[model samples]
Target: MNQNVLIIGATSGIAEAVARHFAEQGARLFLVARNSEKLQAISADLVARGALEVATFVMNANETDRIPQMTDAAWKVHGTIDVALVAHGTLPDQQRTETNIAYAIAEFRTNAESVIACLAALAQRMEPQGKGVLAVIGSVAGDRGRPGNYLYGAAKAALDTYASGLRARLFKSGVHVLIIKPGFVATAMTVDLNLPARLTATPDRVACDIQLAIAKRRDVLYTPWFWYWIMLIIRWIPAAIFKRMKL
Candidate 1:
């Protein structure tokens, strides 16, 4: 079957990588993002690279009121959405969030609420179809709240829980729900962070993992696989001693 994939936040980083992956597989695409220029460029590139079809929607995912209208228009273009990937997120500075409540709130809305709104809209549409996949790009930070990036972690934790519940709710609906937890990705989001190569994964690697997870109907996956064991250990650590140690 010719897959119709909708990628929210398709302009850069892991989302762009996933877009290219699906385009190479001859899937029709609906690329949604805030940047018109980037979206057009990506759409053009995908069409040139063997995408069955490519469409773009320029809108802020945080605009809850606009989600249904935007999704309806995209569905009209593609006919059916076989897969919807909610990949829009923000990683704000930990220190800045302490001094700036506005920044923290913005990050929370962008990383959690916006994705929730968009996914909810897509889920409603996919439920009736009885055959679709909803893949969300979450982070391993949500596994346990560390002091370094607890604000971001907290927001992701909320998202993680939401996705898990959505998966359970959609179990009998025939719509697959996948929650992707990437440890440290070498994307523009982590450009300034000093991360070790072993702990970080590339965009292409993450994209491949996403495809595999969707194909296997996995409910949750940790990119690179090693993170699964690592998080397991982290989750078992004693709170008193774990709180004192830096991650």
Candidate 2:
């Protein structure tokens, strides 16, 4: 059977990588992002690269009311979405968010609320189908809040909790819910940050891991796997010492 995959935030970075991976698998794609030009370019590229089918939706995820309309259009094109990859995200400067309440609010809305609303809409449709996978790209930063990017971490933490609950709720329905926690992915999101090469992951690597996890029906995955152990240790650290250290 041909698979239909819907990927949010497909214009750049990890989402784009995920799209390429699924396209290579001959999955029909419905790519979503705010930029129409980029989405069209991606759609064309995917079709040229041997995708079964390709479509694009230009809508800001922050505009929650437009979600149903956009989703319905995708459903019409692809018939039924077999996989929904919720990978839309924004990473604002942490220091700026500290002083600007508006910036912090925007970050929360972009990273947390928008994802929740869109995923909830998708889940409602997919639950009744009883044969779909809902995969979200989260961050290892959510595992333990560090002094550097606590705001982003907090938003990701909320998403992690939501995905966990969604997984439990949808288990009996045969709809798989996966939460991907990638540690320090080298993408546009982390281009400015100095990170250790040993610990950092590329988007292609992360995308491959995501495909494997979905195929295995894994509930939660830490990209590179070693981050799972690393986060486990970090999660156990005492707040007194953790707060002082710059992680």
lDDT of each: 0.90, 0.90
Residue 210, model 1: Cα distance from true site in angstroms: 0.6
Candidate 1: residue 25 lDDT (0-100)? 92
Give me the displacement of residue 119 in model 2, in angstroms.
0.9
Model 2, 12-131: lDDT tens digits are 698888888888878899999999998888898888877999988899999999999988998899888899999999887999999999999999999999999988999998999898
Cα-lDDT of candidate 1: 0.90
TM-scores for the candidates: 0.97, 0.97
- Predicted candidate 1 versus true structure: per-residue lDDT over 78-120, tens digit per residue: 8788999999988879899999999999988888899899889
Cα lDDT of model 2 overall? 0.90
The stretch of ten residues in a row with the least summed lDDT in candidate 1 is 11-20
